[model samples]
Target chain A: MAANISEETLKVSYEQLSDLEKEFEENEVEIIRHQVALNKPLYEKREKILSELPGFWPLVLEQAPPDVDQYIQPSDSAVLLSSLKNLTVSHFEIDNGGKGDPRSIAIRLEFNENEYFEDAVLEKKLWHRRAKSGWTGLVSEPVPIRWKKPGKDLTQGLLDLVVKVWEEDKKRGPGAAPITKAKDYTPAQKELKKKIETVSMGGVSFFGWFGFRGFPISEEESRAATAKDRENRRLRAEGKAVPDDEDDEEDEDEDEDDDPYGLEIFPDGDELAIAISEDLWPSAIKYFTSAQETGDMSDIDFEDGMDEDDEDEEEEEEEAKGGKEPPAKKRKA
Target chain B: MAANISEETLKVSYEQLSDLEKEFEENEVEIIRHQVALNKPLYEKREKILSELPGFWPLVLEQAPPDVDQYIQPSDSAVLLSSLKNLTVSHFEIDNGGKGDPRSIAIRLEFNENEYFEDAVLEKKLWHRRAKSGWTGLVSEPVPIRWKKPGKDLTQGLLDLVVKVWEEDKKRGPGAAPITKAKDYTPAQKELKKKIETVSMGGVSFFGWFGFRGFPISEEESRAATAKDRENRRLRAEGKAVPDDEDDEEDEDEDEDDDPYGLEIFPDGDELAIAISEDLWPSAIKYFTSAQETGDMSDIDFEDGMDEDDEDEEEEEEEAKGGKEPPAKKRKA
Candidate 1:
């Protein structure tokens, strides 16, 4: 029955739906603004309560939703538990007088003095902005983490490589943006390939997320998106529709394949950031309380049915192989 | 450090946070109301466009999000694709003067003449009602399907059993509600165990969803929730805090185990309903267009790398063992 339907008819209807969707989106933004204002005092109270309870953030992070939790390796978990003092996610653009996106947020992770890193604080700010291609989303840049020793680098130098790549790419003349094709920088691509392999569990370190700068799209891909925007406007003006070019989409996918560094390292960075800011941050008390109920960080179990004691033993075994254990546990011993 | 903090302090802070969360929720309802009004015309337009495109809803269902898609077995898919003509989800209580819950919805599925059932339309209305426990969510009742033959029952008699159980339970005294423990009805529990084992793929049929009433909570469970509500109010009056009874919660979980029929059959029914109504229904055109791009129902692949031709072959093999294929494909062949 779909075979009998003309492409032009479907396109016209699809465009109409798209117009409706835009209206829905604009209305949703208004709701978000109201929520941001209403949640201010609640968030402030949450901050106070969390501070009163030590080791709260660590417990919350241990039971982080699966999306964000997957990025945190066992070594990363050890580091976070030992030093993570507090966590706060703020809608930084909330009070920007409608000039900024309300959804744009800053995630701050404060740490006590630790053996692993020299820095007392690490923060990643995501700005909700639109691209030249007419797509709007949260975009971020790499934040440097000052590891006391190379051996203590939780991201296994992946973050360093990303920083180096961005700096070098920026040095390239105009039009050579940070999120360009990896093939343009063959030397960095060779290094990235080696670094990615060293990462385990089909995911990068939680620390590596600090380097996320959003997904890359080539000039060709951007132009295609722009063309679609033009076509949609033209269809509205002409009061008719034509079949969309599927070939262009296929080519865009092929171009995406050329740049795998940022995508591979933090493919769902924006989503993960949103998840953390919107869900994990506000619900810290709930998550922390649940984690407390278990009497063990059972929610963090990636492997099948591993007990806390078993995990502790495994951590020791991992330490023998040059990994680190939570120093607080060692201090208790 | 948590060991040093008084339980009273934590409890007081948690209650304060809960109060704030309630405010956030009330604000959210306002947003949802605005969206419902703004979307009225858009949904009407969507209905018109969807009617023009044949097999559109089938294709959209074929590409449904994992949450909803998981419930649809291959046999169920064959039935839906063959007969499903139109699907609509409406916020039925939206226009009702503020007394009615705006979130209450009705999901309507229309079908063409088919050999499976006598009914041309199967509609399930889920009312957003508050339970005796003060918990509010979508509550529904079984909408019976008149199967033409015993062999043609897509739910394989689960719906029939559920209906019988509900009817029998309703006949009991006022205290013995529908969601009570399965132990109350020994004969039904025995039959349910038998029917449950026969259901494949750790899920029930798409047709079985017609019988989804919501998660079960016994009278004992309701009293516990009400008691907590009472305690919170008392605490507010007294301006003091007390630790919540973890023992009570443990007992609630134990009681839930005694009533496994509804929970086992549709553990996430409320969540699934929300996903369908909010995401799938509004995004039908997008899902359908993407399905058209593949030209095959690759999104519905349960087994690894199974092509359309392979699926058809498997269907034929299954049919030889007493099943049916989508008659449209059969006619084409």
Candidate 2:
């Protein structure tokens, strides 16, 4: 019986083994099919590129270039012309007094040499028209010529224009131009243009005049204007017309009380107060008196009337009521 | 004559004064009209809010919960429980052969202790039902319980379920249920569930059976598989019948040399010659001689027959032509 049982067990295991083998064959075929499907196209492209490009290695082994140097510098003419070109006159003013050929006319020019020279020369016609109306010109002497540390040359066009202008001025008539002496003319024009151009490039306006002209009001001047305004306002508030400067300076210095009007009652009042302060005062006084009369001065003096004893009583009441005030009584108080 | 000139000057000045005054009055009126035209309503709601809010702040104040301290504690039970409540167990696997039960299942449950405990017990029942219907019966233990820390009492419902399962097992008597010991029930169930959950999370197949459940193939097993694959390929290439592992080891070793046809000769010639060490030269020569007549001595000794001087001359010619032979010549050489 044991031998029979073993034989029967062997037969059952053989049947199981056949079934597993068939399954494994089918699975392996499926796996191979999937792998070929994934890799075939990739392998085909790799093979094609490799087979077609045999000599690619030799072509990649070629030769190459070497190294060198370069830089820049400015010419002396450029330096000189650039400085002179910077001198300029921008606008002019004339106080003609309604007559006499605009006597004492003042001219304002930008202080850059290059731009000023261009305006005066190549663009000379622009200022010449203005000059025809009888304004003489004056320019500040050029400040010491300082080249920009890394000196870059002025443009060829500007340099050419400066030379042309100088030639034209010389041809016009001997000594007819303000710029005289060949040495003085070239270096001075060049230096002036360079300084003016450089300074103007630095964003400064150069202003000068042949006759009297107002600079920007200095701090002292602004203060003087303010003081004069204050004095004028004070005189007008007192119903007194401000006398001209010829008036006795001592009389003007009199104390505020000597004013003809009793405006001295509010000496501290300014133009704002003079116009509206008095009108508002009576209404203000009325409101104050009514507040005082009613003994409801909470708006004026919030804690003044409540005595220390009253405060103590309030605190005690709060403690008695569980650290809170009774709502209606608190409201009334 | 001087008096007449002075009178004329005075007359002209007077006329100019009247004209200037008229122009000034006109300008004053124009300026006033311009000022009135430019007046605009200045009030705006956004501006009012910007000015009136304390510190002129922009965003509205948000009053959040006052007890920020509550979030800082590490062992807050409610926080742990809430996080666990959101915990999701998405899939599971049962340990069974193909005939026992379905391999996979998914679960979603709230954190109620009673519900979690009921679900854990029911999972086994579900597997049993599938098993009775001709599917594999996979025995799985319950999942391990994780908490904020160990030694904390299991959730009330989980503890209750453990007690119930233990009581049921005792009532059923020995061998009636898969879970036998009351002491072992909880941990066994936990370990099974955790394994299934871990495999499911990683998105890998969960194959469970015998002692090898969850055991991955070792590196040695992978190398053996690769070797088997190579042997199969060799059989396919040589058009030989692939043998199973049942082949006698002695016969298989002898078969390595039994290349009945010379089909493998061309593809493997270089590699076989290199692999045959000096000690194996006699055997290699015998195999080669037996494979063919004369062995084509001309092709075998071709490199040896070329004279050294001729080879040098050819190399010099190649060097003269840029040290690069054309692709076809290089291949032939």
List each candidate's DockQ score: 0.18, 0.01
lDDT of candidate 1 over A1-120, digit per residue (tens): 223457777776766666655555555666667667766776776677666676677777765655457667787887787778888877777765554567678999898888888889
Per-candidate fnat, comma-separated? 0.20, 0.00
Winning model by TM-score: 1
lDDT (0 to 1) per candidate: 0.64, 0.27
Place model 2 in a CAPRI quality band.
incorrect
For model 1, what TM-score does chain A reach?
Answer: 0.73
Task: lDDT for model 1, please.
Answer: 0.64
Worst ten in a row by lDDT for model 1 chain A: A324-333
TM-score of each: 0.75, 0.12
